[model samples]
Target: MESKDLKFEEVNEGFNIKEAIDEAKRCLNCKNPLCVQGCPIEHNIPAWIHQLSMGNIGDAMSIINEKSNLPAVCGRVCPHEKQCEGHCILNKKDKRIRVGKLERFIADFDSNMGLIREKLTPKTRGKVAIIGSGPAGLTVAGDLARDGFNVVIYESEPEPGGVLMYGIPEYRLPKEVVRREIHKIEGLGVTYVTNCIVGQNITVDEMFDQQNFDAIFIGSGTAKPKTMNLPGNTPRGVIQSSYFFRMVTLNNNGSVGRNEVPVKVGDIVGVVGCGNVAMDAARTAIRMGAKEVYIIYHKTIEHMSALQTEYNEAVDEGVQFLWETNTKEFVGERGRLKAIKAITNEGEKVIPMDKILLAIGSQPANRIVSTTSGINVDERGYVITKERPYGMTSRKGVFAGGDVVNTPQTVVLAMRDAKKVAAGIAQFVDAKKLLEE
Candidate 1:
């Protein structure tokens, strides 16, 4: 109900027909598009813009589909300022052609109009099992399913879309958009088995031996939230930003009740860290009617990991910034959070806060690797992936990408990793089947 009190509407809106066409027309269609080069997936920026400029929306969507399995999601969440738009020749002129908005427009237009019904490729290649339905998992499933591989996504959650469905806030990326992307992937002939977790209900070995899967992909993005072992610890009212994001989402979507959300109305919230997650937590707290929301970071603004735009918006939305501040201890009353003892550049200060959201960072969960052997991880628990196979694990026929293989990354980056892993899975499965023949 508190989350509902906060509109929870998507922040960015796609361009309308006229605006989209105008923005698309602004593109010079450079022979060597730096925007494409900047893109992790290297989408043909000029071509798609040209298509959109000419009013061929369907054609534009087709070109985008070539490189992205989650164009809509990318359009909504990708850090275009650091990537495509940042490289745009027009950005120097302060007139970058809203690439993200254009992409979002095309995707939204296509989805709303049912303009593209992709020809489903028959699953004749081989069976592939995908763990987690996050960006990485969805990308692998979509890519492989398109290549004639039978893909069955095993999601531990009741619904698919892993992190996309949970970690991200509704205001940033609406659940409907994630659902739409998952539906499109499903149309590619990918099967989804929800409430079934790998490494638990079924093991990677079971997927190969029992289910007859030729290859398996672990796209389980970092689920374990990292927290600092600080002084004056108390359990209640201290929440991980990831957990807060999930609970707020669940509460808003009616999946969970008000009692589940940690940040109550009129509460004073302090989020530790200054990444995008911190910004989200602070803003969400403000929206939830927090008396005050502060972002406490040990470094200055220049040292913050969150995008400049996000910081600016958070400030505009009334999020207070406690720069160069290090949290020393959690001051709690009766095992409940009451204040935070922190030291700042000026001097030591104690801030009264009801909930302290840890937006520090996260590491991969050992759940999947613990149950399956041969999948080696580093001292830090990241899966060891081979370069040749792109994202292949130490175990043959098993692959990993996204946060599990590398550090936790942006959705598009995870998608990019998953795409490479999809190619690797295809290659491995084909070679294995050939040898059997």
Candidate 2:
């Protein structure tokens, strides 16, 4: 699809009722359920499939909710090929099950039918504050809120979904799905405070002293984009993939206008990196009317961190790839990127490009920890935490999880860690409260 012709159409057309039923019937309902084992969040794959096959979609959705708070978002974005469906027994026969599609189907069905009933708790426990409204933070908030903890999420952005609302494009993961999932969290009695920067506006000690939160869960994802130290990085046309994605998502969601989205049509775009974010950047560029889109990766195709399905989709959409190529510098004219100079095994080559999107990776923002004294971070800036207490940080009442601790992992994997951290927080806060009593 040409950029001018590209509507914000959803990439994956959701499964219809009949298709969902047929797919549910395909599940062998393996006793071992390797799909569940393979999932980072350990969704009850077999149980959900059984419920779906029996036409008990609400029950299936409930089963999915037990493990994941963002089923709809995960259904759209999670790389099932590398995770859950990757281990399906049917894969031995070279026929992998459509696990992602089915999960998406059930979740969408429940959402459309308004079958989601809030899971209520008996009484409120101690209060917990979650930083960031991304996957990990939202998961922790949902888990703790359901456990009767007064959970409040603080998001620095205007919206609460974090990366889901900013970094991901609407074509891949719709904003509506993100909004619906967030609504479920809010229904659980969790409060969200937008445009609230914890380290800046309110310090950790201040939260402990004034707010009196029993425990703090830091899920502020790695927002700082990792850049190539190559020359011309400061050029006008050189931009980080995260920033570009945020602009596009915000524009689509009406937070910004279309003119502010950047990357106009007919521009030659080059994306540096081979991860899923790179693919998203390349694809988004295509939809934004880029005449040519190329993904440059230093490693071989096999070593590319992006899921094969994402790569295939990008290729299908006419996005080009230059594997085994390392960018040497961003060649530009008058402070604007004009081309990219790269070195491959063949020799030095220069590709003319109007825009350079850096999707290399990201590092955790240090502002929060650097300003707060009690918390401890390693030389590399990752928070120091013990496994027994799961997500507990250097401070006794503080916990950290998700991309800040583990460099930008998949959304579901982050949620898995968040769930563990939530449990740990509950135990710690409960014990502390009991002692106080």
Candidate 3:
């Protein structure tokens, strides 16, 4: 499809029934599944594929649900090229099994067929307040809610899914898929409170002191984008990729209209960085009508942090790359961006452009830590937690996980961290309850 035609449409057309079964049959069902070992959440790959091969897709989905709450989302956006499929034995023969495609197919099939059986009731465990409805938070809520914990997710945005809702492009991951996955969690009796920024509207202390939540899981993801100290950073068209993506997603969902995003038709776009976010920004810029979209990175292509598949997709979509390039300044006229001056190994060059999107990276927003006392964060602003105790923060009875505790990572990795912290929280809360008894 042409770049101009890229809308909030589903990117990969999911597998149909026959395709799913055929793909599942490709799996040799290795006795020792290295694919599962490579997965962050350690999903039962062989088991699920075996079930699918047996024509029991519902059972396959149930097996998948044992470890994943956002299978459909992960199936769509997870960098399987580097993880599961990359480690597949089939790759040795230059024939990697299409694990991600198969996983997505099963999740999509289950969703369409209403095959996700409810696994929990509200008759056990105490109430837990989960802050931030991102991957980690949502995973914790889903797992705990399924274990009969009254899980309540608090989100700052109007929607429930954080990065899944805003950061990811619609063409890469459709909004409907996110909504469907979230609806499954809601079906498990999880409550959601949107438009509520925790630590501002409700302090962490209040969650325990006044609200009396038995436990708390802080998965508030990193929100503050890092920026270059280059001259003219304050120019009109110099924007962060996160903000740009948020605007694009909102515009696509009718939360706003076109022109709300800073980019315009026929514009030349310059994207700074070479991560997945950079690829997303460049592709989005092209789709937004940019005549040309350039990804400017200080490192070589091999050093790029973006997944190989993402880089390839961007190239396929006509996105350009300027490797080993560093921005010096953004030149503007009448307070709007007009061109960018950058330095490469060869020397300096001025690239005329209408917009510059910054995708350097982001840091955890420390607002919650600032508002709540006793919690400790590193000098770099990451929450400090014990490894053995898993997700316990500096203060007792408080747990933190996901991006807030580590560098910005993939959704599934963050979910893996949250799963560990959930076990920690369960242990801590269960011990406390025993002591009270």
Candidate 4:
């Protein structure tokens, strides 16, 4: 490994066993449990914390597995400040119980000690084929597999984890943690097929009719990154933050070279936008040995979509923030990016930059919809799902959820949607089988 890659080691070292118990012991285990209400998937926060406090690692994991398939991933990445921990009763006293850290500790301890290995249920319910092995697809597969449905996930990448294994940076979420979680899911009788693109290699029709998938789920996330399309966007150094993140991850994992990673060492990099992705890109640039990394946002810090914790960490890591700055144009020459023309509060400013990474956001790709006949999408190409069956698409046996159906969301939000879709798929499959019998 390159000496520079050492900078990418996990920044946050979660609680030790003793520290976790001490923190978990502080949880009030409230009857109302506002933390549960705050969670997107309604995790039984109090129960798991209580279990961890008692050193019942297996019990805590069982509680977590009831609502979550990727406890370790969530423990690391979920926005605790805005959700569960935010609503903790102790927050009023400035003592929020450190729920995220405690959860991380429990998950790590459980995985390390092999405290809980669930018994696999027979796949007698039905066979469900899931597209994309992201948070949503894994949740659906785990949930249905527990309920006796045979689940197979098709992933286009070399590995099963979609964004978890690729899009997210290594420092925040280690690939090993992701692999561990996926390994747990696979233990539940779920099958994975990598390097398989749903739209191209096989179509929805083949899965439903030929391969005999009783229900099909689309959890494929937003693949097409959105760009500002400024005057000099076509320049060589102008890159999409998502693509940059994916390539850098691949490079770090030895699948690709440093040259393929896009951002080079000692480069002066400026990232456009102020969301989490923008923070990730800028911070990643710093770790890659960039001379300077700047986050250029048109809005004030008050309006930033990034978590305050993430922004604070980026600042601590020496990331420069350009706030309330409106980008006018990309000023470059020789087909390579060099500077950005913008207007700050003071007046017009020309910012010199060697590269510009756009972290604006993205939307779902039309690959599956365009290739399939029955599944319908909205004007913006998001799959149209019904509310009655919950995540059922226009076509009867076809279902869609996660970022593919709604706009791009956080990992936990995607899992929440996928869980509902899994239930809906189970209902549809059960009814069809009964009628045929």
Give the candidate number with the greatest TM-score: 1
The global C-alpha lDDT for each of the candidates, from Candidate 1 onward, is 0.89, 0.88, 0.88, 0.89
RMSD of 2: 1.8
* Order of models, best lDDT first: 4, 1, 3, 2
| lDDT (tens digit, per residue) of candidate 1 on 60-115 | 99999999989888998999999999999989999887889889899999999999
Candidate 3's C-alpha runs over 4 A off are 1-5
TM-score of 2: 0.96
Model 3, poorest ten-residue lDDT window?
1-10
TM-score of each: 0.97, 0.96, 0.97, 0.97
What are the per-residue Cα lDDT tens digits for candidate 3 across 1-437? Answer: 22554655675787888988888888888888899988999999989989998899899998999999999998988888788998898989878778888889899889999987775676367879999999999999988887778888989999999999999898999889999999999999999999998878999889998988988888988999998897544788899999999999888888998979888888888899998999999999988888888999988888998888788889988898999888888888889888888898999998898889999999999889998888999998999998757899998888999999988999999999999998888788878888989
- Candidate 2 lDDT over residue span 341-417, tens digit each: 89998999988889989998888889789878888887778877778688998789899999899888879888988
Quote the lDDT for 313 in model 4: 89
Give lDDT: candidate 3, residue 295: 92
Positional deviation of 25 in candidate 2, in angstroms? Answer: 1.6
